[model samples]
Structure formats: structure tokens, C-alpha cells
Target: MKITLPGSKETLPVGKILCIGRNYAKHAAEMQSDVPGEPMVFLKPSTAIVRSGGVVVLPKQSKDVHHEVELVAVIGKGGRNIPEDEALHHVSAYAAGLDMTARDIQSKAKANRHPWSVAKGFDTFAPLGPLTPADQVGDPQQMEVSVTVNEETRQNGRTADMIFSVAYLVHYTSTIFTLEPGDLIYTGTPDGVGPVEDGDVAEARVSGCAPLRVRMSRELD
Candidate 1:
């Protein structure tokens, strides 16, 4: 799907949605997981994207669905093995995104040591907002990320608490795979993540960027 860039008429052709797991110490502990010594990389296909103001259907495959608010870095330049200092140069914009997951499915996968793709990569699972240009969002590492469900705060965090900074994530990820424009990096979510039922309105926001609002509805057979 195409993404709308703030203040630009052009649309971005989304490639891949790269995600990081357990990137916050407090969040890691809350999830009963350990903080990784390095970046934990994962992939979500572009098909999972639900653009800003879209609805997130509670997939029928799982009983419990959870919301994970995150800060998304939109890559504008492509490169491999990017330098640490030059990593930000590859990012053109930032946005608020949700890494929605099926908690029940994920837990089962973890117990079986199976890949989490089925648990996390469902259609409409990734909700993203309009991209704010990089220059307008200074020092993304200090930005605040938050989420409110049904007008109640569920998650609030500052990028300062991130175990791996945005620049480092970009650089490190580039070493493993080529970073391309429109490839999104979901930095990670904060400590507060919980289940959401149908009809819940979840609003995700990143400091200085547009808010991404989504409503949950069950996928009826």
C-alpha cells in the first residue's frame, strides 16, 4: 500500500515492515522476556499495513489481540551496511505505528520455538500514520510515543528509553539486509501493552507526528 507523506503530494510505495522485539527493558520484563544484547529483527510483509485512519479487524485466528504502539522510521535512501553516523541520512520521515499481535498465537509459538510470523503478520495488523519529514522531527531518539484505547491511556513512552537507538537500529539492520526506501522500521513499543476487544478505538502517536487512529472490529466468517 502507498503511504501519505506529510506536506507532500507524493505517495510512498511500501516495501517491507521491519520490526524489533523487546527493545525496551521495562516492556521486555513485562512480557516475561529478556532484553536482547543486540537488536532483535523481524519482518512483517507489506500486506499487513493498514494506513492511517483505517480499521484493524480482530482476526478470527486468535482469541486475544493486543496493541503495541511504536515509532516508525521511514527509510528514504537505500543502502547496505550503513554507517552508524550516517544511518539517519537514510530516513526521510517518521510516523506512529501499531504492531498489532495475536497474543495467544504468539505465546503458543514461543513455547514451541516456532516463528512468530503467523502470530504477528496478519492482514491489517500494522497500522501507520502519515509520515513527518525527518527535518521537522529533530532528534527522534527523544520523541514520545503513546497510545490511548477508548479514551484511556494504555501505553506511554519516550524514545530515550529505547534499548537500541533509531540510528543504531538502522545501521544494524542494514548490515543484515539492504535498507530500501519505503521500508519501515518499527523501533519498538513501550511497557504498557494489553489486549483489545472489538469496538475499541486505539490511537497511536509519535511526538511531532500525526496520530494514527484505528478501531477494532471482529473478522466475521
Candidate 2:
């Protein structure tokens, strides 16, 4: 799928979306999990993306769907085994995004020791905003990221609280998979995650980037 780069006529094709989990200590604690020594990574397919102002069709199989607002790094340059110091140079843009989750399903999967792919890979599971050029987003770690549902704030935290920095995540992930242009890195969420229902409007924001707004609806029979 393709996403339009704001203020420009060009559209960037989306590749794999790599996501970090438990990157925030409080978030990890709130979920009753331990902080990992390293980043816990996962992948979400491109089909899961819903752009700003789009509708998120909550999956019928899930009773508890939660929102996780995140700072997304859009890769501009491709590389393999990139060094941490040079990682930021490969980023083309940044955006505010939501890593929507089927929490009930995820919990079950975790209990069964199964992969979370099905719980996190449904359509409309990922909502993203227009890309803001990296240069315009000054220190990624300093940005404040938040999420609100139906006008009430659900998540509020700063990227500085991340256990794994963006540069480190990039360098580490590249060591496992070849980083390609259009690939996205969803630097995990913070505390205060909760559920959303039909007709709920959720907004995600990252400092210096366009806010991503989306409405939720249950799948029609």
C-alpha cells in the first residue's frame, strides 16, 4: 500500500512495519510484565494500516481492543547491520501512529504460547499520520506522544522514557532484517492503554508531526 507524504505530491509505498513492545517501563509494569533487557520486536503487515481520518473497523472476533499510540520512524535509506550512530541518518520522516491491538486475543495467544500475529494483524489495526520530514522533528526522544479516545486522554508520555532508543532499535533490527526504504519502525507505546468501542474517535499525536485521527466501528455482518 502507499501513503502520501504530506505537502508533497509523492506517495511512499509501505513495506513491513516493525514494532517494539514493552519499550516503556511503566507500560510494561502496568501490563504486569517485566522489563526486558532488550527490545521485544514484532511485525505488522502493510494491510493493517489506516491513514489519518480513516475508519478503523474493529475485528468481530475481539471483545477488547486497545489503543497504543506510538512514534513511527519511516526509513528513507536501506541498509543492513547499520551502526547506532548512523541509524538516524537513514530515517526519512516521522509520524504519530496507533498500534491498535486485540488485547483479549493477544492475552489468549500469550497464554497458549502462540504468535501474536493474528491478534495484531487485522485490517485497520494500524493507524498512521502523514509523514513529517525527519529534520523537522528535532530529537525523536524528546517528543511527547499521546492518544485520546472520544476527547478523553488515554495515553500520555514522552519518547524519552523509551527503554530502547530509536537509534538502537534501528541498529538492532537491521542486524536481523535488511532495512529497506518505506519500512516503518513503530517505537512502542506508553502507559494508560484502554479499550475502545464503536463510534469512538481516537486521536494520536507526536510532537512536530501531524496528528492522526480515526474513528472506530464494529464490522458489519
Tens digit per residue, CA lDDT, model 2, 1-221:
79654345777789889999999999999999999999899999999999999999998899899999999999888999999999999888999999999999999999999999999999989898988999999899999999999999999999999999999999999999999888999999999999999999999999999999999999976
lDDT of 1 by residue, 51-88 (tens): 77789989898989999999999998899999999999
* Most accurate candidate by lDDT: 2
Model 1 worst lDDT run, 10 consecutive residues: 3-12
What lDDT score goes with residue 1 in model 2? 79
Q: Please give each candidate's TM-score.
A: 0.97, 0.97
The per-model lDDT (C-alpha) reads 0.93, 0.93
> Which residue pairs overlap in candidate 1's backbone?
none
